[model samples]
Target: MPDGDRYPLAHRLYPYARSADQDRDAGGPAHHPVIVVGGGPVGLALALDLGLRGTPTLVLDDAEGIGEGSRALCFSKRTLEIADRLGCGAPMVEKGVKWQVGKVFHDTDLLYEFDLLPEAGHKAPAFVNLPQPDAERFLVERIRTAISDGAPIEIRGRNRVTALETSQPARLQVETPDGPYALTADYVVACDGARSPVRKMLDLDFEGRVFEDNFLIADVRMKAEFPTERWFWFAPHFKSGDSALLHKQPDDVWRIDFQLGWDIDRKAELSEDRVRARVDAMLGEGVDYDLVWTSIYTFQCRRMRKFRHGPVLFAGDAAHQVSPFGARGANSGIQDADNLGWKLDLVVRGAAPDSLLDTYAEEREAAADENILASTRSTDFITPKSKASRMFRDATLALAARHPFARAMVNSGRLSMPSIYDSYLSMPDALPDGPPATRPGAPCPDAPLGDGFLLEKLGSKFTLLAIGCAAPETGLAVVACEPTPELTARYLGAAPSALYLIRPDQHVAARWPMADAATVAAAHSHACGATT
Candidate 1:
């Protein structure tokens, strides 16, 4: 027998302030360039990106602060890089549990351990374990700083959108603590969670396969010497469930997940005694711990057919969702913000046509598919239904303990990585012998330069990365770097010098061994979705 949790975590870091728009009665809805619905990590990230880019943006969150519990725990490296670009990565990285090593176990036996980021010379780690609320808080903090520095960003917390119309300038009927008022924006982005109110309001089809099993996410705080590493179990020795996950976070918080099968007592399973019993069993008899927050989830791998719906758009879980297996949930959503921010900024500023926004749908939808497939595969591996399949999985897990070849077959969870967009906006590579990592349509990998790194130089706009050569004048930001060993391996490959046309989102649009002014201009035009 065990006792229930004695500790409860505090939520809500941001305060709700009434907006003047809530009091407007007469004139049509107040108009802004862009408005984001949910103030979770994705929405805050999008608003922050747009704000730093000198675009006026507003965020309307149903809640005043970050959610309770550590909803999303794993933030990926690419996500950290994106956060760096948004000017808020330092605090998060500083405050997170930094680790790249993960170990898998079969029953009481250690299968194998793997390193996510084995190489050096990167700014961010493979992944960081931070509470989702803390991540969102950092974004909000950056938004406030940007505001003080004259970036037009405002967050009206508790200003929920009751209804919305997707006209040319989309109109939204917002409900605040004060009262209800209407407002409009040139573009509306919905970053609401999986059961998105915006998706419901529009009556859009959000389709995907839902797994039957349930998972209990328990965040516990205990004073113990647990290494900051990921530990996963298949048929855990504790005899709690079929599968389990244990991860560490900052502030002595540790997250545990037990996969409860489809057939279980919902009420009994969630009972305080039952939950505590499971926790006690996992930790063994004599560990003192307090449960901070606990949640049960029946995760699904699903997404909307299209992320863009005319004047309105969808990002984050509002657009797609996947099992928590791969830290793909928040990581992918932040990516949505990164993908959409610059494109939306271009369209709003008339620098790029509205059609450019369609590429956001195209690119992010592809990413969603990749995430869904990975999540589905992970779920299937973790909970094999058929007896023969289970046998195979068990054999594979056992063999992975010793054999290197069998380790590849073991799928604890395919971790999240940056999606290489086969985007329509990209111009094909002219040099056949270029580094594949820096090839056209791939997100630029970070490298060492002077005292700083390569990504720090990219900023958030179109730039020309000239290596061992003079950059052609395309009227864009250009950085000339002498080809060091790291640069040569990452960007040059067999070629001695190269010119890369980088998009505003830091994806390589095109790469050439050398380019003249005319060639550079043509590549820029094609990269911007401008066809002659």
Candidate 2:
């Protein structure tokens, strides 16, 4: 048993290196094509995506290793799919806790429990819970392996960005342990956390609402047989009239969050004695447990107006932030990397115009708005700022126990999901009366293909899938899938033959019943943000 800050978690420390010589041979001062600031999951994943696309990338971070404590412990299925595309999903899925059922309680009475995935046959689960440090370590291992395989991805830890210049080629003043150096990149991506120095240098502000209530989060290590599910309580016996959340994690560690009101002393509340008492009251005095880590935080649902600023682009918490209720912060940021990776790769290789980058901002900003709205509503329901809001929330919880309609109104954090890009880069077309899940602007549904999965065949390049029909010969990769009942139900509903043009990120660009080379090419061009 250790204190809050000194929990035993092993992380490999990456060594710092001078990247000046590597870039000098490429061109002028602009040596690296892309420089990713912050070696967190988002930055590392973005670098891996670009590296897989045959682009050289440089990643710089101030810290030597993955962060301590289980900061973010939930991973959505969409995020796992993105990780799977990047070659790190299997490890996470194998090591994480898979859960789809969640229970909501109203003061010692179980109100309702819901299952996220009612039907089976999907490739990925609804969600998985793993420590954030574990996920980051897995990404780092993948990056090192890719580098060993000559993917042109380099990571430099303890390299802090002191200042940034956002000109034609972005320049960063990096401070390392050895000395200070200047590195210039053709394009820079800021995956730095919420207090982003890059965003500050660009004079961008995060605008949104900040809730007054504070929360105490503790990770306790104990041998308890708690079921692997999410248990959320609104007004419980232990912490009467307050909201609490319980989640099971790996290694028999349980994460508990208690809602603390606005006017509380920070030091007194975080004391070891106070935390022990709270745990005793919740888990009972006889249960034995050790406090692994503890922290206090306030919720803020905020985002930058635009994610892209000139040659520097923002992702992850740097671009947007939300409360932990919905687990939207890291999930949406991973999706941002997934969306920007291919577009940036095409732009760097001169295959697509710079306008393609604007679509990333447009689509991710819309996603940010959606996440903020959901997180705000969840926070309001749980905390209830005003008396009337509390009344409405309690009433809904009471009615939810009896009426099925009220169950849908229970907002115990609408979990994160992939955003459907309806208005941004997807080409407008009428779906020919089929399953709407694989429509234009949506993620390509995963199906079992031969011995592998459908997503395994689509990413890293544009793919043209011809289902139950002959495909027109084109420059894009073609996947001709035979019509099976599972494939038809997920991909082709009522059509005998169909054509889908999928982007490098596995999102459906456009689909047609029958398409020629010209039509597919036009749709591909439109997906790349070409006006004509």
Candidate 3:
């Protein structure tokens, strides 16, 4: 067993000094332009995004620091790109275990191994495995740096919201260490997680299905030569009738999940002996491993019907939640922040109307639905509902070993990927013969540019990516990228020249082979919810 003292899991506390005292003396609630609740990955990310865009944000968290254990280990490429834009991607990638290969198994047999990224010329990989705590810490550091540089972002820890008033300008009654105080904001974002207090206070119902089976998640530190790849077993030898997942994290920590049946005694299952017995069975009896943390959770694939409730908005776990079969939880939440940040910034700056925020709900709700569907399918496949379902699942796995066609049907958690927004915000492609890879509503494909990737050249503002031709003069940021063979193949199929109007979030809003300034401006206006 590893020494617990040597590898201590310490919570870094952010000291809370009373800032509401002055407001109390002034006999009114302190006002902020934007107030974000729950300082988790999504909330922090949203604050960072708004801060970077020169929007003053105040973040309130009940907890002092990041959560314990290696939760949400798999960070997807799309999420990494979002983090990169937020100025914290490099550290996460550097600290994470980068891998793309995942192996699915039936009993002792290796059914199939799949590579998520077969061909890669992009800046970020298919996925990286960094513990949630580390990612949160990196974000916190980024926020602190921004705070130092006058970004107008303040994080007050141990400041919990006890009551919420969702008026035009939301009012929140916060309970701090000092005392209870009233606070108000022009806008309130609830990122308080699955058991969101904000959601509860508003009496919002999270409507969805909850799976019967429970999963035992245990983080174990051990010295082993296991390759940094995702290993999944369906009815494995160690756990004879259940599924098991083994994933590697930094610092030699491994996250193991055992799908315990519906009727398991939750407390007994999480006991040290029971947990150790399971780990020993999987890793062999003599393996030296230290139990870091263990928890039992039931899967619930659910979300609120509407992410936006009046002046208050919901992001991350507060808005939607899914079974952790796929890494959709944090990945989707980061995208939520990415989607909301720019839109909210526009509304804050009076560049767009408040109705622009509705577009955020529209686009993100579509994305959430996509994620929910994928996660639900994976959960159902993993934990079959009926005998027939189990039989079919087993047959599929059996055929997957030999039949190439069957491999495509296998669903061992279709890993998280960026969802293409197919809503009204995405303008239809004007060019009939444009490349589908750079189609409107799709994410902007990254390619090699001068010393950096093409995505690096695009600014946070609306950009016109002129490929293989001179960019037309426009008020928006424009970048003329020389079309190399790879670039041409990805962004400019048969066409020699194209103009892509990319959104602030790096999603292509419109594309045209040739367009005058009027057309480009109209597309931009349409993207910002203006009917031109």
TM-score of each: 0.96, 0.96, 0.97
- What local lDDT score does residue 368 receive in model 1, on the 0 to 100 scale? 96
Q: How displaced is residue 282 in candidate 1, in Å? A: 1.7
Each prediction's number of clashing residue pairs: 0, 0, 0
> What is the alpha-carbon lDDT for the whole of candidate 2?
0.87
Residue pairs with clashing backbones, model 2: none
Please give the lDDT score for candidate 3: 0.88
lDDT of 3 by residue, 164-251 (tens): 9999789999998777888888899999999999999999978889899998888888899999899999898997239999999888
The segments of candidate 3 whose C-alpha lies over 4 angstroms from its true place after superposition are: 1-10, 20-22
Per-model CA lDDT versus the true structure: 0.88, 0.87, 0.88
| TM-score for candidate 3, residues paired by index | 0.97
- TM-score-based ranking: 3, 1, 2
Backbone clash total for model 2 is 0
lDDT of 1 by residue, 321-432 (tens): 9999989999999999999999899889998888888989999999999999999898889988789988999899888888999989888889998888887877787867
Candidate 2 has what TM-score?
Answer: 0.96
Q: Kindly state the number of residue pairs that clash in model 1.
A: 0
In angstroms, how far off is 133's CA in candidate 3?
0.6
